[model samples]
Structures are given as C-alpha cells and as structure tokens.
Target: MGPKIKQINRRLNELATEWNSFDLGPSRRETHSFVNSSDVIGRDKDKENIIDHLKEPSEDGNIPVIPIVGIGGLGKTTLVQLVYNDDRITELFPLKLWICVSEDFDLPRLLKLMILSVNKEENCDGLTVESLQTCLRSLLNDKKFLLVLDDVWNENRARWIELRDLLRSMDGLSQRRSL
Candidate 1:
C-alpha cells in the first residue's frame, strides 16, 4: 500500500481500538424497531421542504442536487433517514439507493457501490472506470432512480464533476432528482 493509505489504515485501527475500549454508561437514546415520520420530532418543516423539493419538477432538464449542509450532531443523518424511509418517497421513486460517502471519496468505490446496490450479484472487482460507468449507465437506463449520497466530505470539484458526468451519461438518469 501507499504511505498515505498505510497511515490512514493505521489511524483507523487505532481509532477502532480506542472506540472499542470506551464504556461510559447505559445508552441514553431509546432504540426503536423502525423510525416513522412521527419519530422525527421538530423537523416537520424540514421534512416538508425536502419533500416539496423532491416533488418539484426540474426545469433545466438536469438532476436536481439538494444538499443538506449542517454541522455534525445536528440530526442531519436522522432527517435523511426519515426522508429515505418515508412512505411518499418510497412510493414516488421505484429505484432508491442510499450511499454513505464518508471521508474517502474514491470514485471507483462509489460507482461499484451503486452498481452493487442495484445488482447485488454483479462482481465489481477488477472492473475499470469505463466498465463500471457502462454498467451503471446500463442499469439505470430509462429508469427513475433516487440516489442519496450521504456524509459527503470530498471537496475536489474535478472529482465530483467526473462522477456527476458519469451518472449523467445514463439514459434518462439526469432528468430526475438526487440528494
């Protein structure tokens, strides 16, 4: 592995070990079997706004990218999860995908994840970027898909453009919505 990758792996291992050693007390939050819309308190307005945006028609013939930007621990993920599992959302789009794009913004990995999400049996290993893009384009052709890229941390505009362009290449892919 490269030096940067090795360093990151080592840091991740250390963090994992440190996290496993932590034991403060019992959990304060109540665990639920499922999070209904009612479970998300004080976010009705946010939910409505997002749902409205989802229902809005795109005038530019391009996928609408709605970014929910907030600092950590502000229930950003919770809000998204609620929207993702919402009944209206589930019924609106037939194909739904949730991808958590954390610190590492590897394009190939993200593409592979999308492909695997849609076609679970496909072997994505040893596939080049062109092939992966082709697979994604083929899978999403003439289909309305809802893709949620959560926890995105990458700031490289070029990388984002490359990924976005690949997604746009799919037939009828960029004419709908994204989050």
Candidate 2:
C-alpha cells in the first residue's frame, strides 16, 4: 500500500480502538437522528450545485455519477442529504435510494440493500448475486432513480468494476441514475 493509504488504515485502526474503549452509561442506548433541513447551515451553494447537476441531462444519455468527496466530518453527507431531500430532486427522480457503504463494500450485501431499499417487503434471503441484481433491475425498471452510496471507502478497482458493470446493466431501464 501507498504511504497515504497506510496512514489512513492506521488512523482508522486507532479510531476503532478508541471507539471500542469509550464508555457509555450502562442504561444508555444509542439513538440515530438526521439533521433537519432547517437546521442545516451554510451549505446552500453546495446543495445548489449538486441539484443543478442532477437537473442537467447527460449528452450521451448515460447515467451520471456525481461524487461528493471530502474528509470525515466535513458535512459531505449533510450536503447530499439536503440535495436528496429537495422538493425539485424528489420530483425529478421518482425513486431514491440511500445506502451507507462505510468500509464494507461487499457486492452481494450492497445488492441486497438496494433491493430492500426499493421495496421494504422484499425477501432477499438465500438469493445469489445474480438473482439480487435481477431483482434490483426489475424494481428500477422504467424509473428515474437516485442512489447515494454514502461513506464509501473501498478502493479496489476490480470490485468497483464488477459493481459498476452490474449497475450499468440497469441503464437501459433507468431514465436517470445517480451514484
């Protein structure tokens, strides 16, 4: 690995160790909450640019992948959440899916998540990767979809290519697809 990658891995390991050692009250339970749109401050320009990009049509008629790259805690997730929840964006893309891809980038897991996100009632147990991909394709057929893979840390080119190829197969069914 390169020095930068090694540094990142080391820092991540350190953080994991620190997190594991942190103490919470015995009765405490972690609660997850989203930042309300009203409470999000100082990201109007970033939201606008992303929204504008989403509104623009690709000349090649292919799906566009817009990446929001930044270091941790820089509000990249918040910005995308704002854009994802925007009225115009919702209207433009009828189907929206958000998958949190933090550190674990297993293709089968991702496919299952996508299927579940499309329809919460889906039974994805024991399904192979090909079957999962087929189910996802069916759910996305004839729809304009926005898929947000948040906190993606996988950098394997081969794995990415495999996932991209699977997603690319859905292009014919999707009017617009975002990642």
lDDT by residue (8-118, candidate 2, tens digit) is: 999999988887788542332221114599998999999998998888776774557898897878988888888888889889988898887777778999899889989
Clashes of each: 0, 0
Q: Which residue pairs show collisions in model 2?
A: none
Query: Could you tell me the lDDT of residue 150 within candidate 1?
Result: 82
Cα-based lDDT for every prediction: 0.80, 0.80
Per-residue CA lDDT of candidate 1, range 61-168, in tens?
A: 566889999898898778877877788887777788878787678899989988988999999999998899888888889988788888777799999989878777
| Model 2 local distance difference test score | 0.80
The TM-score measured for candidate 2 stands at 0.79
Lowest-sum lDDT 10-residue window in model 1: 25-34
